[model samples]
Target: MSVKKISRHSPPNCGARAASASVLALMALLGAAAQAADTYNSDRPGGADHRLLSRYQGSLLYMYGEEALGKADMLFDDKGKPVMRPVEGRISNRMYWGPKKKSPLEVYRNYRHALETAGFKTIYACETKQCEAGAVQDAVQDLPRKVVWKDSDIFVENTFNSANQPGFHYYSGRRTGPDGDTYVSVALAGGYEDEPVFGRVRQFVQIVEPATAELGKVSVDAKAIGGALKRDGRIALYGVKFDTGQAVLRPESTAQLAEMAGALKAAPALKVYIVGHTDNQGELQGNSTLSQKRADAVVAALSSKYGIAPARLLGRGVANLAPLASNDSEAGRAQNRRVELVVR
Candidate 1:
């Protein structure tokens, strides 16, 4: 009798409401977990001390021992040429975005300070109007065209534009690491007072570790060269080195030159077409000119220094026309940027 009196009525669909609330709570938990998975921690590798606005992306261009060109400056000359003083090393490019209410200047300063604390000395730094010159804009636009990987250029451009919002800011620096010298370039923009939507700072960091190997002694002797030539009709040479953005050969190239000279001397009837190749890094015309100059330099060295007849070797710059490997990677680029002796 007491139980029947107590079991009167349900409280206005309370059970349904409780079930709905439980479902909502479960969904909320799932949403939070998904968001956490998408967003990286502030201390993510190669990221600054800021909340990651979104997922982080990176491209390891050149491996530990490969060469990479690091941008030392972002400004341009009065003649309109973007002053890209390139630093060579093992290159890695990384990007991250931070959603914060901080101003552009504040974000720039925070990144700069972090870099300094991490032992990076500023190579170049600029802010606002100083960084918004026509040359800078052109450089930003032309980067995709110049780089071998289009995604990297796109990432850089989008990050730079977003972070630098109303104006622009750029920072580049270097630090000595255990492996080698680590170069860092940071481009910060966003949080412009003029734009309401621009509140996120984007950072593009390029780390270039110095190459570990240099041309040592002449490993490829005359016999080896002759055999390779006899078998392949063409032999690609790697030890022939050059300074970054220059036609001049490094002193380390002496061993390779000597070996090449010895090979020609051993074979009296051997004449080769000295073909120069390069990785796709800059303008096609400029690379063609550079390859030509590099070939000329090699020929000149062989003839004048090693007493090989100039007529026996014809210098030709094919630029990146022929690549032995894919140009998508640093190792491949290193392999492509070589001198080849083709039987004429």
Candidate 2:
């Protein structure tokens, strides 16, 4: 996090204010272009950035959600300003950073550049002044996330979360397809200064068509789990069902969870690691953390919901570091994202 700077040098006598403004603008642009210590291509929470876009360089993917058929809030910088336009279809919610100089224009532009490169044609966009006056900020200081677990991604989340919340602005995208013209909307919340600013915040809400999951065709039983773990020392089980961006176990997973508890009960001396996996299709931002949380959730369910001994189940995540199949296809990616009972 950066603190507000106070220059001690005396002001220049000629065109001093103009020089200051010019310098500030230059700094804002430079900050937008500044790369973090490592390259971050965090396009996650689902299958490789469904909109075909990656996050802005140096930005971490804080939170994302998707639904096959849903609705998104559409914002326009037009006469109506920040007023909402709700559109229905396959909905996805993605909130990203506004590591700002307080002047959101610089960071906002760079973020948009990343989106535009993915072939979306911008139809509407705006900065603070362009929005309607008296529009309210989001309900809270920080946008709520689905799960708030401490992961390596938390450090970067802390960095962006510290910035002051600013006014709402927007940009929309339209792409022509054989089906029709699909729209994409991005709303930016930006401020206007540099001396005391450190973050830029924006959100994108989209609706994409829903699709079916071919997973969960078979449920693993206690016999199968024990046999596999005994023979191979581990078993990749897709019986556990987790939604695209969800960390909690679904009610439908009760059958498999019961079977797991059964296997544990049958073998008193056995202990296993409930390892979680997510396919690395687009980005690696919070995949490991997300995977860890999912694994932990499974462990919690087995212990509290069922009667598995807590000490016997250790949970961990391996991100996309290990993949059982290629990420080039949805089928292969599904196979890659699974939970395994690895004997300890």
Candidate 3:
């Protein structure tokens, strides 16, 4: 066919091209929004942004990937009846499942699969709320490949998910351990007693753990030491035996030591003073000696076993001075025997 001659300055085809490009841009924006709603920042703890988890107001939460399954908060319907609705991502109980009547392992597996399909590689999960120390350790040991645990506390692990987005999930129930390691768990969310409002497809996206520089691990007991380490320059660690009064280091102390060592190593400039205490059973002088001995023992272990410097280790004896529990009873006496660390 003979080609028709085209004028060099004819109305450009730019109109159609511009319209196509606009459509493409709109699609891209929409796609990005959808993705944002789907992805998890494993480092973000709660699957949202750092600011939201930093202050953490309200009881609303939005579940992505495994979190979306069968979770919602109860709201009174227009008919004065209770209904479940989507909880805001930052608010607590947003995806409250109330209580699980089924097996926690089942729930964990289901969530794990759902998360994996969404391409979230850092999957943190728990089986129950009251888990045994051994159970939690086992769960941690059994974590899927490539998932790094920030702490051994199952409950805190859940909160870690709430604070970060790398495919974090939690389960409610109890875990029992036979003296392997004391498993401390923090229930950050879940148990809202509602059904799933989102569709069956759980969204998952890659997320970096919240920068260790901010919104770090969370602690529920006492001073919330985990957050202290991440947000503040100092974290005070006190070691105590179970049932109190016993100056001997308890098994739980192992976990704390591990954490303290790691914190010191991570921040080379950090220094810590390890203090030991004894109950009031013995004479003041004897208790002081015992406390000093215990403190020295800790220093020796840290320096020799863990490679912490003697200069970095300061041992103090607080003899029956700091009592967390009443010393009137044997239980309280047990509480008085402890070792603590003051960050310098």
Candidate 4:
């Protein structure tokens, strides 16, 4: 299920028009309030401020969320492409709604200055050329699974993904420190051919603080995987790591995914169920949805990246129903959060 493509309104001034055209046609009730300082209301009920940076005064915060471990594309490579870097620490995404007259370039430049003034060195700056969608989507799409998102979040995500495509500005910078580095990427656009009420300019901001990904926490050894499957019906794998609220496996999980592929190759006739399990933190239904997506992600990764046969692997999600350990404590919860391969 792909997100609805709606931000088709490309500003006339923005050089490259987005492939399509459509501003977010939100529900009438919600659309009226997307702006923070509208005629009747000027209240800030949503998250007012982000930790590393402050919000632009005039814009309304459409959405705000953070991830413990997430992926973000940062510095540009020699080919002038954004590098998809895994953020180890806290990843904060803030989406804002800007006034129509204001072009996206203005807000983007202000954000660039803020980062630079705060000691962040500009690493990737492509002001005129359009920014890549992956760098923007990575931040916009990562939301917590536990909470029921507001209508505004969906609207913001849809609008920015379309608006940031072409005729926009992208800037990413990093700051070095003794402990680690901080990364910030800003994507914004201001060209609306259609509805003016939906917001002429929108900005998507992602900030990554330094942290550890618990590297080498687990080894993806085919021999061990095979041995465990031979002895037991299934084996629990923690090596397939995910952010607190994300289903996509972390880059660190590549080794494990590769080994899983190897294990399947060793036994040509082997057919197994790839089961996704989660801690009992959020609602059961929500956890089940996340688990299912994760199971599907693993299956897709195996099929696409490792050349594992799709027929050989079946994906399922049992949510918190099958717990490896008690969910009473943090350690137990961590133990319970795992992906398992059970022999069929």
Top-TM-score candidate index:
4
What candidate 1 gets wrong by more than 4 Å, as runs, is 1-218
CA RMSD per model (angstroms): 14.8, 18.2, 18.3, 19.6
Q: Write one digit per residue (lDDT tens) for candidate 3, span 1-344.
A: 99877679875676888999999999999998766544321122453322212212221233322221122221223343222232211112122221223333443455445434534332133434323322333333222122232222332224323222222234221122221111111122223121321211121111222111111122224335444655664443444333333445546566566666666666667676777766678688887877887787778777786788888888888788877767664445545555666776
TM-score versus the correct structure, for each prediction: 0.40, 0.39, 0.32, 0.44
Tens digits of per-residue lDDT for model 2, 1-344 = 99866566855454778888899999987776553322232433443344555555554454566666444555544454445555545555555554444344555676577658867676666655544433323411232232222233442233224333455555677665533446666555552233222344454334343222567757899998899989999988888988887898877788888888888889999999999999975557689888999999999999998888899999999889889988665656888989889999
Sorted by lDDT (best first), the order is 4, 1, 2, 3
lDDT value, residue 158 of candidate 1: 45
**Cα-based lDDT for every prediction:** 0.65, 0.64, 0.43, 0.72
Q: What does candidate 4's lDDT look like per residue over 117-157, in tens digits?
A: 99998777776443544454344333222222333434554
- 182-226: candidate 1 lDDT, tens digit per residue: 666666556334232245555554556655333333457677888
Worst 10 residues of 2 by lDDT: 139-148
Candidate with the larger lDDT of 2 and 4: 4
In what order do the candidates fall by TM-score, top score first? 4, 1, 2, 3
Q: Which residue pairs overlap in candidate 2's backbone? A: 90-207, 90-208, 98-199, 98-200, 98-201, 99-200, 100-199, 100-200
- After superposing candidate 3 on the true structure, give the runs of residues whose Cα lies further than 4 Å from its correct spot: 1-226, 229-253
Segments of candidate 4 deviating more than 4 angstroms: 1-46, 130-154, 160-167, 191-199, 213-344
Q: List the residue pairs that clash in candidate 1.
A: 163-189, 163-190, 164-189
